[model samples]
Target: MFFQTEFTHVIELFQLPFMQRALLGGILTGIMGGVLGSFTILRQLSFFCDALGHSALLGISLGYLLGLNPSLVLLPFAVIFALAVSYLLEHTRLWTDALLNIIYSSSLAIAIIILSFVGQYKGGLNNLLFGDILAVQQLDLVLSSLLLIVCTIYIGMTLRTQMLLTVDESLAIARGVSVSTQRTVFIVLLSLVVGISIKSIGVLLVSAFVVIPACAARLMSRTFTHYVLLSAGLGALSAVLGMVSSAWFNLPSGPSIVATQLAIFLTAMVIPRLRSVTHSPSTLPPQV
Candidate 1:
Protein backbone atom coordinates (compact mmCIF):
# COMPACT_ATOMS: atom_id res chain seq x y z
CA MET A 1 0.00 0.00 0.00
CA PHE A 2 2.85 2.38 0.83
CA PHE A 3 4.55 1.64 -2.48
CA GLN A 4 1.32 2.24 -4.35
CA THR A 5 0.80 5.53 -2.57
CA GLU A 6 4.36 6.57 -3.37
CA PHE A 7 3.82 5.72 -7.00
CA THR A 8 0.75 7.90 -7.17
CA HIS A 9 2.60 10.72 -5.46
CA VAL A 10 5.39 10.48 -8.03
CA ILE A 11 2.86 10.64 -10.83
CA GLU A 12 1.38 13.79 -9.35
CA LEU A 13 4.79 15.36 -8.97
CA PHE A 14 5.53 14.75 -12.62
CA GLN A 15 2.88 17.27 -13.60
CA LEU A 16 4.43 20.01 -11.47
CA PRO A 17 6.38 21.65 -14.28
CA PHE A 18 3.25 22.25 -16.27
CA MET A 19 1.42 23.42 -13.18
CA GLN A 20 4.19 25.81 -12.22
CA ARG A 21 4.21 27.47 -15.62
CA ALA A 22 0.46 27.69 -15.70
CA LEU A 23 0.36 29.24 -12.22
CA LEU A 24 3.04 31.76 -13.06
CA GLY A 25 1.41 32.63 -16.37
CA GLY A 26 -1.96 32.90 -14.70
CA ILE A 27 -0.66 35.29 -12.04
CA LEU A 28 0.87 37.61 -14.60
CA THR A 29 -2.20 37.38 -16.78
CA GLY A 30 -4.35 38.26 -13.79
CA ILE A 31 -2.34 41.40 -13.12
CA MET A 32 -2.52 42.40 -16.78
CA GLY A 33 -6.18 41.56 -17.08
CA GLY A 34 -7.05 43.29 -13.84
CA VAL A 35 -5.31 46.56 -14.60
CA LEU A 36 -6.14 46.78 -18.28
CA GLY A 37 -9.57 45.43 -17.67
CA SER A 38 -10.32 48.22 -15.26
CA PHE A 39 -9.67 50.62 -18.10
CA THR A 40 -11.58 48.41 -20.50
CA ILE A 41 -14.60 48.31 -18.23
CA LEU A 42 -14.45 52.00 -17.41
CA ARG A 43 -14.05 53.00 -21.03
CA GLN A 44 -16.95 50.76 -21.96
CA LEU A 45 -14.62 49.01 -24.38
CA SER A 46 -15.28 45.41 -23.49
CA PHE A 47 -16.78 44.90 -26.93
CA PHE A 48 -13.66 46.38 -28.47
CA CYS A 49 -11.53 43.94 -26.53
CA ASP A 50 -13.76 41.11 -27.71
CA ALA A 51 -13.30 42.23 -31.27
CA LEU A 52 -9.55 42.42 -30.76
CA GLY A 53 -9.64 38.92 -29.33
CA HIS A 54 -11.06 37.68 -32.62
CA SER A 55 -8.54 39.72 -34.54
CA ALA A 56 -5.81 37.78 -32.77
CA LEU A 57 -6.84 34.68 -34.60
CA LEU A 58 -5.60 36.28 -37.77
CA GLY A 59 -2.23 36.93 -36.21
CA ILE A 60 -1.98 33.41 -34.86
CA SER A 61 -2.67 31.78 -38.16
CA LEU A 62 -0.32 34.11 -39.97
CA GLY A 63 2.40 33.34 -37.43
CA TYR A 64 2.03 29.59 -37.71
CA LEU A 65 1.86 29.54 -41.51
CA LEU A 66 4.84 31.86 -41.80
CA GLY A 67 6.96 30.13 -39.14
CA LEU A 68 7.28 33.18 -36.90
CA ASN A 69 6.70 33.56 -33.18
CA PRO A 70 2.96 33.92 -32.84
CA SER A 71 3.06 36.45 -30.02
CA LEU A 72 5.61 38.66 -31.75
CA VAL A 73 3.70 38.53 -34.97
CA LEU A 74 0.42 39.08 -33.19
CA LEU A 75 1.85 42.07 -31.34
CA PRO A 76 2.30 44.08 -34.49
CA PHE A 77 -1.03 43.02 -35.86
CA ALA A 78 -2.81 43.92 -32.67
CA VAL A 79 -1.12 47.31 -32.58
CA ILE A 80 -1.97 48.04 -36.16
CA PHE A 81 -5.53 46.92 -35.74
CA ALA A 82 -5.87 48.99 -32.57
CA LEU A 83 -4.44 52.05 -34.27
CA ALA A 84 -6.65 51.66 -37.27
CA VAL A 85 -9.71 51.21 -35.16
CA SER A 86 -8.82 54.19 -32.99
CA TYR A 87 -8.28 56.36 -36.02
CA LEU A 88 -11.55 55.28 -37.55
CA LEU A 89 -13.40 55.88 -34.32
CA GLU A 90 -11.94 59.35 -33.95
CA HIS A 91 -12.13 60.61 -37.52
CA THR A 92 -14.86 58.84 -39.41
CA ARG A 93 -17.65 59.22 -36.85
CA LEU A 94 -18.73 55.66 -37.59
CA TRP A 95 -20.20 53.79 -34.65
CA THR A 96 -17.52 51.90 -32.71
CA ASP A 97 -19.54 48.69 -32.69
CA ALA A 98 -19.92 48.77 -36.44
CA LEU A 99 -16.18 49.25 -36.84
CA LEU A 100 -15.48 46.34 -34.52
CA ASN A 101 -17.70 44.06 -36.52
CA ILE A 102 -15.98 45.02 -39.73
CA ILE A 103 -12.56 44.34 -38.18
CA TYR A 104 -13.20 41.18 -36.17
CA SER A 105 -15.51 39.36 -38.51
CA SER A 106 -13.24 39.86 -41.50
CA SER A 107 -10.16 38.90 -39.52
CA LEU A 108 -11.81 35.80 -38.09
CA ALA A 109 -13.02 34.58 -41.46
CA ILE A 110 -9.57 35.09 -42.93
CA ALA A 111 -7.95 33.26 -40.04
CA ILE A 112 -10.26 30.29 -40.39
CA ILE A 113 -9.45 29.99 -44.07
CA ILE A 114 -5.70 30.24 -43.49
CA LEU A 115 -5.62 27.87 -40.56
CA SER A 116 -7.71 25.27 -42.28
CA PHE A 117 -5.21 25.16 -45.09
CA VAL A 118 -2.29 24.32 -42.82
CA GLY A 119 -1.61 20.59 -42.65
CA GLN A 120 -2.46 18.89 -39.40
CA TYR A 121 0.11 18.24 -36.72
CA LYS A 122 -0.38 16.84 -33.27
CA GLY A 123 -2.62 19.27 -31.36
CA GLY A 124 -2.30 21.53 -34.41
CA LEU A 125 -4.93 24.19 -33.95
CA ASN A 126 -5.59 23.30 -30.36
CA ASN A 127 -2.58 25.29 -29.23
CA LEU A 128 -3.96 28.41 -30.81
CA LEU A 129 -7.59 27.64 -30.13
CA PHE A 130 -7.55 26.44 -26.53
CA GLY A 131 -3.94 26.85 -25.32
CA ASP A 132 -1.55 24.18 -24.08
CA ILE A 133 0.00 25.14 -20.79
CA LEU A 134 2.28 22.10 -20.79
CA ALA A 135 3.89 23.44 -23.94
CA VAL A 136 4.98 26.73 -22.36
CA GLN A 137 8.74 27.18 -22.63
CA GLN A 138 11.02 29.21 -20.39
CA LEU A 139 11.23 31.95 -23.01
CA ASP A 140 7.45 32.19 -23.28
CA LEU A 141 7.21 32.49 -19.52
CA VAL A 142 9.89 35.20 -19.44
CA LEU A 143 8.28 37.20 -22.23
CA SER A 144 4.86 37.03 -20.60
CA SER A 145 6.29 38.06 -17.22
CA LEU A 146 8.16 41.02 -18.69
CA LEU A 147 5.09 42.25 -20.57
CA LEU A 148 2.98 41.98 -17.42
CA ILE A 149 5.48 44.05 -15.43
CA VAL A 150 5.58 46.73 -18.08
CA CYS A 151 1.80 46.89 -18.29
CA THR A 152 1.46 47.12 -14.52
CA ILE A 153 3.93 49.98 -14.27
CA TYR A 154 2.56 51.86 -17.27
CA ILE A 155 -1.04 51.56 -16.16
CA GLY A 156 -0.21 52.45 -12.56
CA MET A 157 1.56 55.62 -13.59
CA THR A 158 -1.17 56.80 -15.93
CA LEU A 159 -4.24 55.61 -14.05
CA ARG A 160 -5.28 59.06 -12.87
CA THR A 161 -5.31 60.42 -16.38
CA GLN A 162 -7.12 57.35 -17.54
CA MET A 163 -9.70 57.75 -14.82
CA LEU A 164 -10.22 61.38 -15.73
CA LEU A 165 -10.70 60.51 -19.36
CA THR A 166 -12.99 57.66 -18.53
CA VAL A 167 -15.26 59.83 -16.44
CA ASP A 168 -15.39 62.74 -18.85
CA GLU A 169 -13.31 62.84 -21.99
CA SER A 170 -14.18 66.42 -22.92
CA LEU A 171 -13.35 67.58 -19.39
CA ALA A 172 -10.05 65.74 -19.47
CA ILE A 173 -9.24 67.37 -22.81
CA ALA A 174 -10.15 70.73 -21.38
CA ARG A 175 -7.74 70.12 -18.52
CA GLY A 176 -4.78 69.43 -20.86
CA VAL A 177 -4.80 65.66 -20.58
CA SER A 178 -4.16 65.08 -24.33
CA VAL A 179 -7.08 62.72 -24.45
CA SER A 180 -6.34 61.48 -27.96
CA THR A 181 -2.74 60.52 -27.23
CA GLN A 182 -3.71 58.95 -23.91
CA ARG A 183 -6.48 56.99 -25.56
CA THR A 184 -4.03 55.81 -28.20
CA VAL A 185 -1.53 54.80 -25.54
CA PHE A 186 -4.20 52.95 -23.62
CA ILE A 187 -5.18 50.91 -26.67
CA VAL A 188 -1.59 50.00 -27.41
CA LEU A 189 -1.03 48.83 -23.87
CA LEU A 190 -4.14 46.70 -24.00
CA SER A 191 -2.90 45.13 -27.22
CA LEU A 192 0.37 44.19 -25.61
CA VAL A 193 -1.38 42.59 -22.66
CA VAL A 194 -3.69 40.70 -24.97
CA GLY A 195 -0.75 39.59 -27.07
CA ILE A 196 1.09 38.25 -24.05
CA SER A 197 -1.92 36.40 -22.66
CA ILE A 198 -2.75 34.66 -25.96
CA LYS A 199 -0.50 31.69 -25.25
CA SER A 200 -2.40 30.80 -22.12
CA ILE A 201 -5.97 31.76 -23.02
CA GLY A 202 -5.87 31.44 -26.84
CA VAL A 203 -7.23 33.82 -29.44
CA LEU A 204 -10.80 32.66 -28.97
CA LEU A 205 -11.32 33.48 -25.30
CA VAL A 206 -8.61 35.96 -24.39
CA SER A 207 -11.06 38.82 -23.89
CA ALA A 208 -12.54 36.94 -20.99
CA PHE A 209 -9.24 37.48 -19.27
CA VAL A 210 -9.96 41.18 -19.63
CA VAL A 211 -13.71 41.23 -19.10
CA ILE A 212 -14.86 38.45 -16.78
CA PRO A 213 -13.08 39.35 -13.56
CA ALA A 214 -13.69 43.02 -14.09
CA CYS A 215 -17.40 42.35 -14.45
CA ALA A 216 -17.36 40.14 -11.40
CA ALA A 217 -15.57 42.76 -9.32
CA ARG A 218 -17.89 45.50 -10.53
CA LEU A 219 -20.68 43.57 -8.91
CA MET A 220 -18.85 43.40 -5.60
CA SER A 221 -16.99 46.71 -5.24
CA ARG A 222 -17.76 50.41 -5.60
CA THR A 223 -14.36 52.08 -5.52
CA PHE A 224 -12.11 51.90 -8.59
CA THR A 225 -8.95 50.93 -6.73
CA HIS A 226 -10.69 48.20 -4.80
CA TYR A 227 -12.40 46.98 -7.90
CA VAL A 228 -9.11 46.68 -9.82
CA LEU A 229 -7.37 44.79 -7.03
CA LEU A 230 -10.31 42.49 -6.43
CA SER A 231 -10.58 41.75 -10.13
CA ALA A 232 -6.88 40.93 -10.37
CA GLY A 233 -6.99 38.64 -7.36
CA LEU A 234 -10.04 36.88 -8.66
CA GLY A 235 -8.50 36.50 -12.12
CA ALA A 236 -5.33 34.98 -10.71
CA LEU A 237 -7.22 32.66 -8.38
CA SER A 238 -9.47 31.50 -11.18
CA ALA A 239 -6.52 30.82 -13.47
CA VAL A 240 -4.67 28.73 -10.91
CA LEU A 241 -7.77 26.82 -9.86
CA GLY A 242 -8.81 26.20 -13.43
CA MET A 243 -5.41 24.96 -14.50
CA VAL A 244 -5.17 22.59 -11.57
CA SER A 245 -8.68 21.33 -12.00
CA SER A 246 -8.16 20.87 -15.73
CA ALA A 247 -5.08 18.78 -15.15
CA TRP A 248 -6.75 16.68 -12.50
CA PHE A 249 -9.90 16.14 -14.49
CA ASN A 250 -8.41 15.94 -18.00
CA LEU A 251 -10.27 19.00 -19.19
CA PRO A 252 -9.28 21.82 -21.52
CA SER A 253 -7.45 24.55 -19.62
CA GLY A 254 -8.80 27.50 -21.59
CA PRO A 255 -12.45 26.60 -21.26
CA SER A 256 -12.01 25.37 -17.72
CA ILE A 257 -10.44 28.65 -16.65
CA VAL A 258 -13.20 30.62 -18.33
CA ALA A 259 -15.80 28.41 -16.70
CA THR A 260 -14.29 28.99 -13.29
CA GLN A 261 -14.29 32.73 -13.90
CA LEU A 262 -17.93 32.68 -14.95
CA ALA A 263 -18.78 30.73 -11.84
CA ILE A 264 -17.13 33.41 -9.72
CA PHE A 265 -19.03 36.07 -11.64
CA LEU A 266 -22.27 34.22 -11.03
CA THR A 267 -21.50 33.93 -7.35
CA ALA A 268 -20.81 37.63 -7.14
CA MET A 269 -24.08 38.32 -8.91
CA VAL A 270 -26.02 36.04 -6.57
CA ILE A 271 -24.52 37.40 -3.36
CA PRO A 272 -25.86 40.88 -3.99
CA ARG A 273 -29.24 39.48 -4.85
CA LEU A 274 -29.25 37.36 -1.73
CA ARG A 275 -28.29 40.32 0.45
CA SER A 276 -31.00 42.46 -1.07
CA VAL A 277 -33.55 39.77 -0.27
CA THR A 278 -32.50 39.25 3.36
CA HIS A 279 -32.22 42.94 4.26
CA SER A 280 -35.45 44.75 5.00
CA PRO A 281 -36.47 47.78 2.97
CA SER A 282 -35.57 51.14 4.47
CA THR A 283 -38.30 52.60 6.69
CA LEU A 284 -37.22 56.12 5.78
CA PRO A 285 -38.95 57.87 2.92
CA PRO A 286 -37.18 58.43 -0.39
CA GLN A 287 -34.89 61.41 -0.57
CA VAL A 288 -36.55 64.62 -1.69
Candidate 2:
Protein backbone atom coordinates (compact mmCIF):
# COMPACT_ATOMS: atom_id res chain seq x y z
CA MET A 1 0.00 0.00 0.00
CA PHE A 2 2.82 2.36 0.87
CA PHE A 3 4.62 1.55 -2.35
CA GLN A 4 1.45 2.09 -4.35
CA THR A 5 0.77 5.41 -2.69
CA GLU A 6 4.30 6.61 -3.35
CA PHE A 7 4.09 5.53 -6.96
CA THR A 8 0.81 7.30 -7.40
CA HIS A 9 2.22 10.47 -5.91
CA VAL A 10 5.19 10.27 -8.26
CA ILE A 11 2.88 9.92 -11.22
CA GLU A 12 0.83 12.85 -10.05
CA LEU A 13 3.93 15.02 -9.69
CA PHE A 14 4.34 14.91 -13.43
CA GLN A 15 1.11 16.84 -13.89
CA LEU A 16 2.88 20.07 -12.99
CA PRO A 17 4.66 22.03 -15.74
CA PHE A 18 7.82 22.44 -13.71
CA MET A 19 8.11 18.75 -12.97
CA GLN A 20 7.57 17.87 -16.60
CA ARG A 21 10.37 20.20 -17.73
CA ALA A 22 12.70 19.00 -15.00
CA LEU A 23 12.20 15.39 -15.97
CA LEU A 24 12.77 16.12 -19.64
CA GLY A 25 15.94 18.09 -18.88
CA GLY A 26 17.14 15.40 -16.52
CA ILE A 27 16.74 12.66 -19.11
CA LEU A 28 18.50 14.65 -21.78
CA THR A 29 21.38 15.60 -19.49
CA GLY A 30 21.57 11.99 -18.35
CA ILE A 31 22.04 10.64 -21.85
CA MET A 32 24.66 13.26 -22.69
CA GLY A 33 26.46 12.83 -19.40
CA GLY A 34 26.50 9.07 -19.70
CA VAL A 35 27.79 8.90 -23.25
CA LEU A 36 30.33 11.70 -22.88
CA GLY A 37 31.27 10.53 -19.42
CA SER A 38 32.08 7.08 -20.70
CA PHE A 39 34.51 8.62 -23.13
CA THR A 40 35.77 10.97 -20.41
CA ILE A 41 36.42 8.15 -17.95
CA LEU A 42 38.09 6.04 -20.59
CA ARG A 43 40.32 8.97 -21.42
CA GLN A 44 40.80 9.85 -17.75
CA LEU A 45 39.33 13.35 -18.20
CA SER A 46 37.26 13.69 -15.05
CA PHE A 47 39.33 16.69 -14.05
CA PHE A 48 38.77 18.19 -17.45
CA CYS A 49 35.01 18.35 -17.03
CA ASP A 50 35.28 19.47 -13.42
CA ALA A 51 37.65 22.20 -14.41
CA LEU A 52 35.36 23.31 -17.19
CA GLY A 53 32.66 23.63 -14.58
CA HIS A 54 34.84 25.94 -12.54
CA SER A 55 35.72 28.06 -15.52
CA ALA A 56 32.04 28.67 -16.10
CA LEU A 57 32.02 31.09 -13.18
CA LEU A 58 34.13 33.49 -15.19
CA GLY A 59 31.67 33.31 -18.01
CA ILE A 60 28.78 33.75 -15.64
CA SER A 61 30.50 36.77 -14.19
CA LEU A 62 31.04 38.18 -17.63
CA GLY A 63 27.38 37.78 -18.42
CA TYR A 64 26.54 39.68 -15.27
CA LEU A 65 29.07 42.37 -16.03
CA LEU A 66 27.50 42.80 -19.44
CA GLY A 67 23.92 42.60 -18.18
CA LEU A 68 23.05 39.69 -20.48
CA ASN A 69 21.63 36.24 -20.08
CA PRO A 70 24.30 34.13 -18.42
CA SER A 71 23.96 31.16 -20.75
CA LEU A 72 24.30 33.38 -23.78
CA VAL A 73 27.64 34.69 -22.64
CA LEU A 74 28.62 31.33 -21.13
CA LEU A 75 28.36 29.33 -24.36
CA PRO A 76 30.80 31.45 -26.32
CA PHE A 77 33.28 31.67 -23.49
CA ALA A 78 33.16 27.91 -22.94
CA VAL A 79 33.67 27.21 -26.62
CA ILE A 80 36.64 29.54 -26.73
CA PHE A 81 38.11 27.93 -23.67
CA ALA A 82 37.57 24.52 -25.15
CA LEU A 83 39.29 25.55 -28.34
CA ALA A 84 42.28 26.82 -26.44
CA VAL A 85 42.46 23.76 -24.23
CA SER A 86 42.18 21.44 -27.18
CA TYR A 87 44.96 23.24 -28.98
CA LEU A 88 47.26 23.12 -25.99
CA LEU A 89 46.37 19.49 -25.28
CA GLU A 90 47.23 18.52 -28.81
CA HIS A 91 50.30 20.68 -29.10
CA THR A 92 51.85 20.80 -25.63
CA ARG A 93 53.19 18.31 -23.12
CA LEU A 94 51.35 19.61 -20.07
CA TRP A 95 49.28 17.01 -18.25
CA THR A 96 45.56 17.42 -18.98
CA ASP A 97 44.76 17.35 -15.26
CA ALA A 98 47.37 19.89 -14.42
CA LEU A 99 46.40 22.19 -17.24
CA LEU A 100 42.73 21.98 -16.36
CA ASN A 101 43.45 22.82 -12.74
CA ILE A 102 45.48 25.82 -13.73
CA ILE A 103 42.75 27.02 -16.02
CA TYR A 104 39.93 26.55 -13.54
CA SER A 105 41.85 28.15 -10.71
CA SER A 106 42.69 31.11 -12.87
CA SER A 107 39.08 31.35 -13.99
CA LEU A 108 37.76 31.16 -10.46
CA ALA A 109 40.16 33.86 -9.37
CA ILE A 110 39.10 36.06 -12.24
CA ALA A 111 35.48 35.34 -11.54
CA ILE A 112 35.95 36.42 -7.94
CA ILE A 113 37.65 39.63 -8.97
CA ILE A 114 34.89 40.38 -11.42
CA LEU A 115 32.12 39.48 -9.02
CA SER A 116 33.51 41.93 -6.53
CA PHE A 117 32.89 44.65 -9.11
CA VAL A 118 29.62 43.37 -10.56
CA GLY A 119 28.06 43.32 -7.07
CA GLN A 120 25.86 40.28 -7.29
CA TYR A 121 24.92 40.96 -10.91
CA LYS A 122 22.11 38.52 -10.49
CA GLY A 123 20.80 36.25 -7.78
CA GLY A 124 20.92 33.41 -10.29
CA LEU A 125 24.68 33.21 -9.76
CA ASN A 126 24.18 30.98 -6.77
CA ASN A 127 21.94 28.70 -8.76
CA LEU A 128 24.62 28.40 -11.45
CA LEU A 129 27.11 27.36 -8.84
CA PHE A 130 24.96 24.64 -7.27
CA GLY A 131 22.19 23.95 -9.81
CA ASP A 132 18.38 23.92 -9.34
CA ILE A 133 16.51 21.40 -11.47
CA LEU A 134 13.09 22.51 -10.28
CA ALA A 135 14.00 25.96 -11.56
CA VAL A 136 15.16 24.78 -14.96
CA GLN A 137 13.51 26.67 -17.80
CA GLN A 138 11.96 25.54 -21.09
CA LEU A 139 15.01 26.88 -22.92
CA ASP A 140 17.27 24.68 -20.82
CA LEU A 141 15.17 21.66 -21.71
CA VAL A 142 15.35 22.47 -25.42
CA LEU A 143 19.09 23.09 -25.34
CA SER A 144 19.82 19.87 -23.47
CA SER A 145 17.61 17.89 -25.83
CA LEU A 146 19.46 19.36 -28.76
CA LEU A 147 22.76 18.43 -27.15
CA LEU A 148 21.59 14.84 -26.73
CA ILE A 149 20.57 14.64 -30.35
CA VAL A 150 23.80 16.13 -31.62
CA CYS A 151 25.89 13.81 -29.49
CA THR A 152 23.84 10.85 -30.63
CA ILE A 153 24.24 11.78 -34.26
CA TYR A 154 27.95 12.42 -33.95
CA ILE A 155 28.58 9.18 -32.11
CA GLY A 156 26.39 7.26 -34.51
CA MET A 157 28.27 8.60 -37.47
CA THR A 158 31.69 7.88 -35.99
CA LEU A 159 31.16 4.92 -33.73
CA ARG A 160 33.94 2.82 -35.15
CA THR A 161 36.46 5.59 -35.10
CA GLN A 162 35.47 6.69 -31.64
CA MET A 163 35.80 3.14 -30.30
CA LEU A 164 39.11 2.58 -31.99
CA LEU A 165 40.42 5.88 -30.68
CA THR A 166 39.33 5.14 -27.15
CA VAL A 167 40.65 1.59 -27.12
CA ASP A 168 43.84 2.18 -29.06
CA GLU A 169 44.86 5.54 -30.41
CA SER A 170 47.80 4.17 -32.35
CA LEU A 171 45.57 1.62 -34.02
CA ALA A 172 43.00 4.29 -34.75
CA ILE A 173 45.66 6.42 -36.40
CA ALA A 174 46.84 3.47 -38.40
CA ARG A 175 43.26 2.87 -39.44
CA GLY A 176 43.08 6.46 -40.78
CA VAL A 177 41.05 8.10 -38.02
CA SER A 178 41.84 11.81 -37.71
CA VAL A 179 42.63 11.73 -34.03
CA SER A 180 43.23 15.47 -33.69
CA THR A 181 39.96 16.49 -35.27
CA GLN A 182 38.04 13.88 -33.36
CA ARG A 183 39.51 15.01 -30.08
CA THR A 184 38.78 18.66 -30.82
CA VAL A 185 35.21 17.97 -31.82
CA PHE A 186 34.63 15.86 -28.73
CA ILE A 187 36.13 18.55 -26.48
CA VAL A 188 34.01 21.26 -28.06
CA LEU A 189 30.89 19.18 -27.58
CA LEU A 190 31.86 18.52 -24.01
CA SER A 191 32.22 22.24 -23.43
CA LEU A 192 28.87 23.05 -24.98
CA VAL A 193 27.18 20.38 -22.90
CA VAL A 194 28.90 21.60 -19.79
CA GLY A 195 27.99 25.22 -20.49
CA ILE A 196 24.35 24.49 -21.13
CA SER A 197 23.98 22.13 -18.20
CA ILE A 198 25.44 24.51 -15.63
CA LYS A 199 22.11 26.23 -14.97
CA SER A 200 20.36 22.97 -14.18
CA ILE A 201 23.10 20.85 -12.56
CA GLY A 202 25.39 23.60 -11.26
CA VAL A 203 29.13 23.78 -11.77
CA LEU A 204 29.99 21.97 -8.55
CA LEU A 205 28.03 18.79 -9.29
CA VAL A 206 27.61 18.53 -13.04
CA SER A 207 30.79 16.54 -13.42
CA ALA A 208 29.39 14.06 -10.98
CA PHE A 209 26.55 13.52 -13.38
CA VAL A 210 29.05 12.76 -16.11
CA VAL A 211 31.51 10.66 -14.12
CA ILE A 212 29.53 8.62 -11.61
CA PRO A 213 26.99 6.90 -13.84
CA ALA A 214 29.63 5.95 -16.37
CA CYS A 215 31.81 4.52 -13.64
CA ALA A 216 28.90 2.47 -12.35
CA ALA A 217 28.21 1.15 -15.82
CA ARG A 218 31.86 0.25 -16.24
CA LEU A 219 31.97 -2.05 -13.24
CA MET A 220 30.51 -5.18 -14.84
CA SER A 221 30.31 -4.48 -18.54
CA ARG A 222 31.51 -7.43 -20.66
CA THR A 223 31.89 -5.76 -24.04
CA PHE A 224 32.30 -2.29 -25.50
CA THR A 225 28.72 -2.36 -26.69
CA HIS A 226 27.54 -3.38 -23.24
CA TYR A 227 29.68 -0.68 -21.70
CA VAL A 228 28.28 2.09 -23.86
CA LEU A 229 24.67 1.04 -23.59
CA LEU A 230 24.86 0.40 -19.88
CA SER A 231 26.50 3.72 -19.14
CA ALA A 232 23.90 5.73 -21.04
CA GLY A 233 21.03 3.72 -19.59
CA LEU A 234 22.34 4.08 -16.04
CA GLY A 235 22.83 7.79 -16.48
CA ALA A 236 19.31 8.35 -17.75
CA LEU A 237 17.82 6.11 -15.08
CA SER A 238 19.72 7.85 -12.29
CA ALA A 239 18.72 11.31 -13.46
CA VAL A 240 15.02 10.45 -13.67
CA LEU A 241 14.99 8.67 -10.32
CA GLY A 242 17.07 11.39 -8.69
CA MET A 243 14.61 14.07 -9.73
CA VAL A 244 11.71 11.99 -8.45
CA SER A 245 13.52 11.32 -5.21
CA SER A 246 14.32 15.00 -4.79
CA ALA A 247 10.69 15.98 -5.25
CA TRP A 248 9.48 13.33 -2.84
CA PHE A 249 11.89 14.35 -0.11
CA ASN A 250 12.02 18.09 -0.81
CA LEU A 251 15.74 17.89 -1.23
CA PRO A 252 18.09 20.01 -3.31
CA SER A 253 17.79 18.47 -6.72
CA GLY A 254 21.46 18.64 -7.81
CA PRO A 255 22.97 17.11 -4.72
CA SER A 256 20.15 14.63 -4.34
CA ILE A 257 20.60 13.39 -7.88
CA VAL A 258 24.34 13.16 -7.49
CA ALA A 259 23.92 11.29 -4.23
CA THR A 260 21.62 8.84 -5.96
CA GLN A 261 24.18 8.30 -8.72
CA LEU A 262 26.88 7.82 -6.11
CA ALA A 263 24.78 5.21 -4.39
CA ILE A 264 24.36 3.37 -7.66
CA PHE A 265 28.09 3.52 -8.19
CA LEU A 266 28.72 2.08 -4.74
CA THR A 267 26.25 -0.69 -5.46
CA ALA A 268 28.03 -1.36 -8.71
CA MET A 269 31.33 -1.51 -6.85
CA VAL A 270 29.99 -4.16 -4.47
CA ILE A 271 28.18 -6.28 -7.02
CA PRO A 272 31.27 -7.77 -8.62
CA ARG A 273 32.76 -8.80 -5.32
CA LEU A 274 29.54 -10.45 -4.29
CA ARG A 275 29.23 -12.22 -7.61
CA SER A 276 32.77 -13.50 -7.42
CA VAL A 277 32.30 -14.81 -3.92
CA THR A 278 29.01 -16.43 -4.82
CA HIS A 279 30.49 -18.11 -7.87
CA SER A 280 33.62 -19.32 -6.14
CA PRO A 281 34.23 -23.10 -6.38
CA SER A 282 34.46 -23.38 -2.58
CA THR A 283 30.97 -21.91 -2.28
CA LEU A 284 29.36 -24.48 -4.56
CA PRO A 285 27.17 -27.02 -2.81
CA PRO A 286 28.94 -30.38 -2.62
CA GLN A 287 25.65 -32.30 -2.80
CA VAL A 288 24.99 -30.75 -6.21
lDDT tens digits, residue span 1-288, model 2:
988887788789888999889888888888899988889899988888898888988998888888997779999999898788777777879887787778889998999788888766556567868888888898888888888899989987888888899989999999888888999899999999888888888988889878999999999698877888788998888888899898777788888879889989999999999999988879556884
RMSD of 1: 4.2
lDDT of 2: 0.86
Worst 10 residues of 2 by lDDT: 119-128
Q: Rate the local accuracy (lDDT) of all candidates.
A: 0.81, 0.86
TM-score between model 2 and native:
0.93
lDDT of 2 at 179: 89
Segments in model 2 whose C-alpha atoms lie over 4 Å from true places: 1-9, 283-288
In the range 163-273, model 1's lDDT, one tens digit per residue, is 788889888988899977888888998887777778788877889989999999989998987887888888888887777667666788788889989999999999999
Tell me the TM-score of model 1. Answer: 0.88
Q: Using Cα atoms with residue i matched to residue i, what is each candidate's TM-score against the true structure?
A: 0.88, 0.93
